[model samples]
Target: MATPNELTAMRRAIAISAQGLGTTSPNPPVGCVILDRDGVPVGEGYHLRKGDHHAEVNALTAAGERAEGGTAVVTLEPCNHHGRTPPCRQALIDAKVSRVLMAVMDPTSRGEGGAVVLEQAGIEIERGVLEQEALLVLGPWLHSLSTGRPHITWAYGVDTDEGHSNQALTELRRRHDLVIRRDGTIEEGVPGGHGADSFRVPLPALGDEPGKALHVLTESGARTVLIEGRSNEAARLLADAVDRVIIDVPGTRPSFSLTGPGAESAVPGGFCLSDVKPSGYRVRLTAERVTQDQ
Candidate 1:
């Protein structure tokens, strides 16, 4: 086990690695911590991109010979399988690492416990350090990996000074950047039903749909869709036809193929939507109820 200071250092290392996630695509985010002989941290790293140094390798390079007797703490297990780079398990062994601490186990079936790999190599291993915090950061990506889809996270900003209602408007507007805008034709999943201009509703009301159709309408090109946990029943109903799924809200994991009429959705109250500059074939939405939470 690492000392309190070493543990704190490990967390800082993970936070730095989290920033790399935004820029790294087609690869899962990872964080690593290298401790000195005395179990103090010497170096740290996170996965930053495809075809680049992995977190374990980067940390090993930074620690050099010092890694020979050091323990490595990581947010995710050292991957034993290969893809763009060599297996991280081999890198740690070559570095002469003596021990490993992992917060979360890799869910990939081929990624059988990194702790087991290190232990077989004669290094000490322990699992689950700061598990909850690590899971929260890793939740969406891990969920995506397990389900073969993209993770969806809703960002809501709100002002505390004013009442909750007024604050919601400001927050919704800022988070709209994460979504693409839809314009022109919006397709209904039902066959043989042509789209009608008169059928269009203000973008925000779409959120009231069983699946909160605002994001779904704009995501015209998405082959697989993951709806937030707060999405309406309409969105839930679309799940089976959609390529994949992700639920962001707490409680209840949804597993439906489609939404029936008059069903209720989980979209939060007070969300209103407006049109954005639609480019190409997409619908744009600006939320009326989002305030930046300071």
Candidate 2:
């Protein structure tokens, strides 16, 4: 059983993990909170990027001597393997943390065995504390690990005539691992500071689909692909590889519809409205494809 303090710390760790979404591709976003023996949080940190200090290290550094005999609540299991940085399990052991609470297990073979290492150091281990909630932050990374492909999302804004652009969509682009555009299209550059790699592919040939382009991108290790545009190429992606759709409407409309021939067919079977909320002056709608297994 998880104590309320531990659960709250794990939630904080999950929120901090989101800070690395666009920046930490190929690596899962991880967060950590250090709590003193009194169960009061002493330090909090999140992994910023590859080759940087991990969340546990940063949190431990912030806690300093307070980390000894404290609890470490982390969004993902502490890494055990040596990568760009040293294994986090060793860091926790060195910090003298007495207990560890992790929301999710590390799915990768290299990332496994950390809990064992910690347990051997005489640290109390608690797994699956708020596991489902952690998935909301770790979902795309886990999906990429499981399928060997990046998760795909189609985003665009609808205008009265020419489709307008949404700032939220622009921010989302920064978080993706890759951005896809049609060949010959002039680069307008990313709206905000860009973090994702960009690729331009020729339109899918007749009798072919845009999924082939996605395959190439995913093969290059793109864990989150953003298809942003209103061109025929974007339309074809909607028909083929999109896993989710995000639309920004100018106002509150009783109903919504996509305009184009075969637009309805382009959506994956079993897609249903998953979210509708207000964004600034506009309304944002999200639809996700649901498989039977779900």
Candidate 3:
């Protein structure tokens, strides 16, 4: 239970901790902040690598003797179980920290709640301060843990009409907002997972018209796309772009607003009749047609 002023300090601590997550394979991005008794920030930290000092420890060390009798604010609860190093809970206690404020609890099976461990040590502990923001920062890491492979969430505007195109991908790269996230694997529940495999950089930028030759090249790499039978030209363009294309053509006349990649429905004419859906409803060009166009 930190005071209002102390809570603000805690938020900043978590923000700082998030900065340390760079190129650290298989490790979540983490951040931490340390406050002297007066609630003045003396240090901050972010996780550097797999077996390095966690954000909390780095912040504490940055605080040095100032950490004694002071408070520690961290993004993730200080880990109470050991892996590459001893539990952070013991480190905080040994450092003589008088109070601890945490954002989110760790999800790893090896993770033991840090707040519980700290409270048992007789140190004051506060939990759930700015938890949502903390979780958002840790989303990639958590997703990797849960799905066994990289987590995929299509994003952007609030409508189904929005999609990637040759020019758009290029523009995104120029703007630098679009990033390809991949984690090889986390645990053995599945297989061949290593954790954050690699990131694809400089995704092709969108052209002036949004549809371009480069976008066609990118479509070749996609697993699937969401489409409605209404836009045949768009569908065919997309179909030629990706390895597999999923176009929605209603058997009878009923529509649903549910849209997004991988949404489940019992709708008929889904992935049915490559010829009709692709050339007629989705795309009109077959290999011969495309050859003629060439």
Q: Against the true structure, what is every candidate's RMSD?
A: 14.3, 4.8, 14.6
Question: Which segments of candidate 3 are over 4 A away from where they belong?
Answer: 109-112, 153-294
Q: Could you tell me how far off, in angstroms, the CA of residue 144 lies in candidate 2 after the best superposition? A: 0.8
Question: For residues 104-201, could you state the per-residue lDDT of candidate 2 as single tens digits?
Answer: 99977363489988998899999999999999889889988886777877766664322335566557766776665543232222332223343232
lDDT score for residue 77 of model 2: 91
User: lDDT of each model, Cα atoms only?
Assistant: 0.54, 0.75, 0.53
Query: What is candidate 1's TM-score against the reference?
Result: 0.57
Regions of candidate 1 where Cα sits further than 4 Å from its true position? 109-112, 155-178, 182-294
Worst 10 residues of 2 by lDDT: 184-193
Give per-model TM-scores: 0.57, 0.82, 0.54
* lDDT for each residue of candidate 3 in 1-294, tens digit (9 for 90 to 100): 568866787667656654543333355667888888787888888875567788888888899999888888887778878777778888899989899888777876354477787898899988887888787566545654563433222212212333333343333322111223222111121112112223222244333332473343233221112222223233343333322222222222156564543222311222222232231222221111122333
CA displacement after TM-score superposition, residue 294 of candidate 2 (Å) = 2.3
User: Candidate order by lDDT, highest to lowest?
Assistant: 2, 1, 3
- Quality of model 3 by C-alpha lDDT: 0.53
Best by lDDT: 2
